[model samples]
Target: MSTWLFDLGNTRLKCAPLRDDGSIGEVVAIAHDDAGAWLDALPTGEVACIASVASDARRVELLDALCARFARLHRVRTEAALGPLRIAYAESAHLGVDRFLAMLGLCGAHAALVVGVGTALTVDLLDAAGRHRGGRIAPSPQLMREVLHARAAQLPAAGGEYAEFADDTDHALASGCEGAALALVERSLCAAHDLLGETPSLHLHGGGAETLRARLPAHAWTPEAVLLGLARWHVLRIA
Candidate 1:
C-alpha cells in the first residue's frame, strides 16, 4: 500500500507516491481532467492518502474514485500536517490547507520564502520570528505568455530551452514576458528580504518554477525545493 499526494495547481497537477516507510518513490504530473483515468492507468495498490485542490466537481469525483480504490483517503485539508510544518493561514480554516502544509517545508531559523508558481505565482513569506506575514499572487508564466501573445504583434517563439535572440519585436515580447516573470520572482524574493530586514530563504515550487529557475537570483530553490518538501511531507507522517 502507498499514499498518493497530489498537488493540483492552476494549470497542472503533480502526484507523488509515498511508501509506508516515508519514502517518496515517484513523482509525476498529468492534466487536471485526466486524474481519474490517470490513476486507473496505474497498477492498483491501496492508496493511503489523497490530496487535491483541483475543482469542486472534479475533486468530488476524484475523492470518490480514490476512496473506492483505497481504504484510507486523506485529502489534504489546510490544517492537515504536510512535509515538515504546521499550516497557519490568515483565514486559518478558510485558506486552502495545502499552502499552509507546504509552508512548513518553507520555514527555517532564517526567514522563509514559500512560493507556488503555477497558473498563478503565489509568493508567501514566513518571517524568522515564525510569523505568517501573508503573501502576494501574481500572473503565472502562462498568463504572462498569453498576455504577451495578445499584446505583441510579432513576438518570436520562446520556451524550449534558453537562447539569445535578436532584439526584434518577437524577441522583445519573449524577453519582456520571460524577463517579467523572472523579475517577478526576483522582485518578490528581494521584497521579502527587504521587508524582513534579513535575507529570506527562497523555496520555489509549482509547475512553472523550473523554467524560471535559471533566470532567478541565487536563493531560488525550484524543483529541488518542491521534491525535497514532498519527501519531507512523507517523512513527517505515515512512516
Candidate 2:
C-alpha cells in the first residue's frame, strides 16, 4: 500500500512517499505563499502521516484537503520520551513536533546536536544515551533580513550574498544575518561538547540549511529528517 508523509513548516510543505525499505521517496515542496494550491495535485494514498507547525488556520485547510484524499491520517505530536530519547522539556508538548521528530530521525547511541534552519533557527542537543539536553531558537537569516527591512524601509528583504567583508549594503545584510546564525551554531557546538564531555555529531536541516552548510564543514545535512521521523512513527504505530 502507498503511504505519504507531509511535513508542514511555517514557510513550506514537504511531502513524499514512504518506500518499502523505510526511506522517503522523491520530495515535493510547496510554498506557503501559494496557499496549498498544489495539494490538489497530490495522488491519494492509503495512509497519510503529517507533522505540522504552521498556523491553526493553515493547518485546518491542509487537514481538510488531506482528509478528502487519504484513507488513514496520523498526526505526529511531541512526546516527553520516544524510544531511547528523553525530552528535557518540562512540558514536552511545548516542544515543536518538527524538532522532536528530527531528533528521532537522528536517534542512536551517539550524542548529537541537531540544528534546524527554517523560518526559525532551532538547536536541540541529544546526548549519547538519547537524552534531550535542551536547545535554543532564534530568528533565521531570512527572518532577520525581513525584520530589518520591515523596520528600516530602505533595506531590501531579499537578494544578497554572504561575505567576510561586504562592500555593499545588500551583502552586508546577508553576511550579518547569516553570520549570526553561524555564530549560534558554533556556540551550541561548543556547549554540547562541554556538556557531553565530547563533541557531539552535528546535523543540519531545513530551507536555510544550504546557506549555512559551507560554514559548518563537519555537520551532516539531512533535509528530510522530519519526513523520515514521521515514517518511523508510522511503522511503530502500525506494528
Candidate 3:
C-alpha cells in the first residue's frame, strides 16, 4: 500500500499519498482547524504521519481527538531524525519543521530558494550543493495588512492578489499588501542569491502562495513545492 502523509502548515493542512518513487500524488488542502472534519471523511487508509510547525500541545490536542481513527500516527518535529537534508541553521530547533521538510522536497539536484508565504512568510535557502544554509521569517501579508489597518483607520484591507488601482487609497492598499509580501520574498531570495550566486529554482508554497505567486517574477517556480517536499521527506524517513 502507498504511504499516507500529512503536512500541517500554518493556515492549511495538506494531505496526500506518496509512491515508492520520490514523486507525490493527489494533494488535498484543508483548513488547519477543520482537520478533524477531514479525518472523519478520509478514505480507509492507514494512520497518518504528520509534519507540523505548530506546537506539540496543539498536535496533542488534535491527535487526542483523532487518534481513534488515524493509526500509526507520527508528528514530524525538529527532534525527528532527519537524515535527508543537511540542517545548517545555528538554531535549527527554532526553525519550523514544515519549512525544513519543504527544503528537502524542493531541493532536487539544484539549489532552491524555498519561500513559504502563509500565516507567516518564510524563505529558507538550500545551496546548489544541497547544503542547508539558513532562512528568515517575517509577518505574513495578511498580518502586515491587518497591522496597518489596525493602526491607521484609513488603510483598507488588502491581500497579495495583484490588481489595478483607481485612487491613492486603492493604490496604497494594493501596493501595501503586494509590496510588503514581495518585499520579504525578494529580500530573502536576494540574500540567498547573494550567497548561492546562481539562478536558483525559486519555489513558493503554503496558503498564501496563490496570492503571492503572481507578484513573483515569471522565472520563479511555485508548484506545490512544500507539499512535494513534504512528500519527499516522508519517503526518505520511512523507506
Number of the top-ranking candidate, with lDDT as the measure: 2
lDDT of 3 at 56: 63
State in Å the error of residue 177, model 1.
Answer: 2.0
After TM-score superposition, what is the CA distance of residue 213 in candidate 3 from its true location, in Å? 2.5
lDDT of 3 by residue, 219-238 (tens): 45555666666666666666
Candidate 1, residues 1-239, lDDT tens digits: the string is: 55666665544556667666655567776665544665464333465445455677766766666666677765655553343344445456765545665676566676787777666777778877656777777887667777666787454335433435544655555566667677776787778777878778777777667777777766656453443445455566554
Each candidate's clash count: 4, 0, 2
List the candidate 2 regions with Cα displacement exceeding 4 Å. Answer: 33-36
What TM-score would each prediction reach against the true structure?
0.77, 0.95, 0.83
By TM-score, highest first, what's the ranking? 2, 3, 1
Q: Compare candidates 1 and 3 on lDDT and give the better one.
A: 3
Candidate with maximal TM-score: 2
- Superposition TM-score, candidate 2 onto the true structure: 0.95
As for candidate 2, its clashing pairs are none
Q: List the residue pairs that clash in candidate 1.
A: 78-97, 83-233, 155-170, 156-170
Which scores higher on TM-score, 1 or 2? 2
